[model samples]
Target: MQWKQNLNHWLHHLPENDPLKIELENYQSDDKLMEDCFYKELEFGTGGMRGIMGPGTNRINLYTVRKAAYGLSQYIKDQGQEAMARGVAISYDTRHLSKEFALEVAKTVGAEGIQVYVFDKYRPTPLLSFAVRHLNTYAGVMITASHNPPEYNGLKMYGEDGAQLPPDAADVIIDYMNEVKTELLIEVAEVKQLEKDRLLTYIGKNEDIAYIHSLDSIKLNDSANNKDLSIVFTALHGTATETVQEAFLAFGFTKVKYVYEQCGPDPNFTTVKSPNPEEADAFTLAIQYGKGNNADIILATDPDADRLGVAVKDEKGEYVLLTGNQIGSIIIHYLLEQKLEAGTLPKNGVVMKTIVTTELARAITGTYGLETMDTLTGFKFIAEKIQEFEQTQDHTFLFGFEESYGFLIDGFVRDKDAVQAAVFIAEAAAYYKAQGKSLFDVLNDLFEEFGYYIEETHSITLEGKDGAEQIERIMESFWSNPPLHIGGIQVVEIEDYMTSIATELPSGMKSPIDLPKANVLKYKLEDDSWICIRPSGTEPKIKFYFGVKGKTAEIARNKLRKLKKLLLQGVHV
Candidate 1:
């Protein structure tokens, strides 16, 4: 078989004493395991490439790390002397091989005569983004899988604007990656020696200070910064403690408590099933501490600290987890209200959200006279919008968020920032406290003002090569033939992002979709409900996103249940 031939090729090239060779020898007797590892190389997906740690082309080991760095090195070289001199900034999280992979990239990039700046230890993803712009580097690398399971790790690449590479630039990097014949044979420069030559610099405290200073500008309610609220924070066994804690202290919230078990750099993420803030089970420890301390709000950040999960007290004094949509809308309401009162709200302001995000954002922004913009499903597209607004100065970029618990408040950092988000949540909680209400009350009032909007995402996991093909087949089926009705609701319109067209169903009136083409299908129901089906760009699964707006919360919940059930049944994977 071709996979066996590739396996033998890798084994032949690896040295006997190498750690990867030793690992391959142990799995030699198992054909399935070896085939899984050797069948294909890990490709850069939505954010970047990610895989389990092991010894093959499909795995995320040192050699694959070197391969990515090699590709990036060549790309920088092609950009000419200025890019080489400006160099790359690299950082890692608490995951296994994170630091090792980061160092490997530095060495590989330096070996190709490009200067490299690397963190001495683990840092959050946003800091890496901030560092890219702060250091005036041409590119940046963050070694993290960002909320994936413990066994998974990956690298995310950032362009000079500090956003993930858009499709055009990613194509160039992939071309360079494909040209690397033998990854294990790539050479690396020595870090210690490179330091002496001033080609390698370790970044930490200074960058942290500068990043913290930038985060401070996200605050809108100076009067609401009183220490009137009790808060509980958890890093979920990752790298958010120091920065998050410092930011809360800066906001004068003296009653903040930390979930000790989940604090600070634990690659295993021992406390939770998954260190994802989007999941309810991931907040067990934080909620427990919150209940014990009678905290007003509970905040949890994922491993790499880019996404934040929140729990707020309801009128009954029970802790309720806030969906990403709920949290984002709360912040938008608070910021918009404050700015409007202060008369600082920009007349031509814009709020950005992913196509699948809650329509509540549009409702809230519209009431305040701010326009809303929708981007394709990724933070990179949102970042690109911010870059455009900054260059054109046509509109003020107020805030951008995704349904997956990622948010960006300030354009200073061209990515989602839990540090900035944590601060805002704290202030928002306090603002409500001053008004003798809770965060839940604020959301309830919003629902009463606007229509009740509910959104949920569900996915089915499939693995290996066959699973990938299955996902594609499922998407293709939806693209070629879409159902006229789902759960007794007639389909009114269909948006085919992959074809960059929107067709009004039954009538068949077509309009061009200005966004980039992507393999995603969205169905707008006759009742104004919607369902979106798209393959998970960063996972071996297919995701189904459901959205429903009703006159009341109970009505919205029931509609969401029916639509979700119907859509999940149709999704084969």
Candidate 2:
């Protein structure tokens, strides 16, 4: 069928209450707007699905949510009665309509005769991961868009082991979702009926208590007490405020202050341009609060509370927001130091990071006779490794982190736990304070020891269907005509994860990559600089990551700037 004809069919068939149809009605004369809305179904990538909130086959709304849930329900039922009995756990952040979508998912799965454990109120993404394992659910679902804007929302699924469904499992779910024909006909058990049947359970405060207790176990250096140290925290108007504040108090920090303006859950994230803690602008209000309170440290979490971001008072008394790489390095150094000192550092201990993360973590890992493994740029692979460790090997999983503000310490939850991270980071701060040092001081010491390793992520947002094709074309262009050098540095090695091949530029020799296949390309430069290109799994954006190491911070910054220019140039063509 012609594209316009297919669109017209959907338009005519769309329900009157459908937001997409309503918007389309207003745009009837605007062919471009109509085409954009009906161009294609929103792409469901490995990170689950995310898009602008609306009603359409190509948007994230009630109908699409129901279809995805129906697909998940079918997948569970196909696994047999035992899987259905085991049930599914569902949670949601404070995004618009997040709770409604989560309840809809529960109803859809309930109609399949599967049990459902739905959180009674807003919760963090990691808690959903924890609930999956704690309740022994067959799968888990979290309705969140992570740090995306207010207009965006998403759905993420996790397998029985509490990790995001691996590619093979995700493919199966995607197939079933695509096969779903009509959203209106999607089967969903009435909420009251499911509740009466005892098939829909509402998770409550007890789970939160258990989760916080698990976070308490993450403290490796309890003997170091620094109750006098002042700190400020912000949830960026999301769901972490109460939990983080409580965790800090539990860790014996008495001077913690919350950013009042952004303390409560605000779906619109009214104050900040973006709810993402990774950006310095997101912490503006928190910084002001920190300065006023004489805070030695500042912490912020994204909307879903899965990723953590921090700032510390430098020697100049200015609040400086640390990059994800810098925070990861500090955490690694602190954890290893305390563990080794306490003689609890495992001989077979391992740490996991993404390919785009700073190599400083690897350098720090080596100092304590520990090993660091690299995965693609997602926390799921790190979660996969934690599961791998529990099932096989004796290697103790000490910590896992990604370059994008996500970190995990204890394996109680498979995904990143900012609540847990906040606890440990507070403990780390207390540990430093006991020695009369600030987190900034500790970070500087780490840089001095591991060389100044700096990393930056540049993302290019391309909207609509054409943007996706452009991203693919750009990636293919790099693969077909690989760079010989970047920023005048020799390309020593190229790792093509899609082909599972790592080729040595100098020797022209290739070796198999030990990790799972991904649509990523990395160029390792001779001067310890690297560039990687990968499309964002949850948004219409392509990311260019650059990491450079130098004897000094200025040199590292310079190298990163040159590499950034080269990367932009490569993507432009």
TM per model? Answer: 0.98, 0.97
Best prediction by TM-score: 1
Per-residue accuracy of model 1 over 1-573 as CA lDDT, tens digit each: 888887888899988898989988988999888888988988876457988888889999999989988988998999999999999999999999899999999999999889999987799999999999999999999999999998899999999999987888788778888998878789999988889888899989999889888877887878344587999999999989998877887788888899888897888888899999998899898888998999999999998889999999888898899999999999999989989998989998999999999999999999987899999998999999999998999999999999999998998888888888988878988988988989999999999999899999988788888888898898888877798898777899999998899999799999999999998999999887888888888888888899999999899999999888777776665
Residue 396 local lDDT, model 2: 85
Superposed Cα deviation of residue 254, candidate 2 (Å): 2.2
Minimum summed lDDT over a 10-residue window in model 1 is located at 219-228
lDDT to native, each model: 0.90, 0.87
What candidate 2 gets wrong by more than 4 Å, as runs, is 1-3, 18-20, 223-226
lDDT for model 1, on a 0 to 1 scale?
Answer: 0.90
RMSD, every candidate, angstroms: 1.1, 1.5
Residue-level error in angstroms, candidate 2, position 95: 1.1
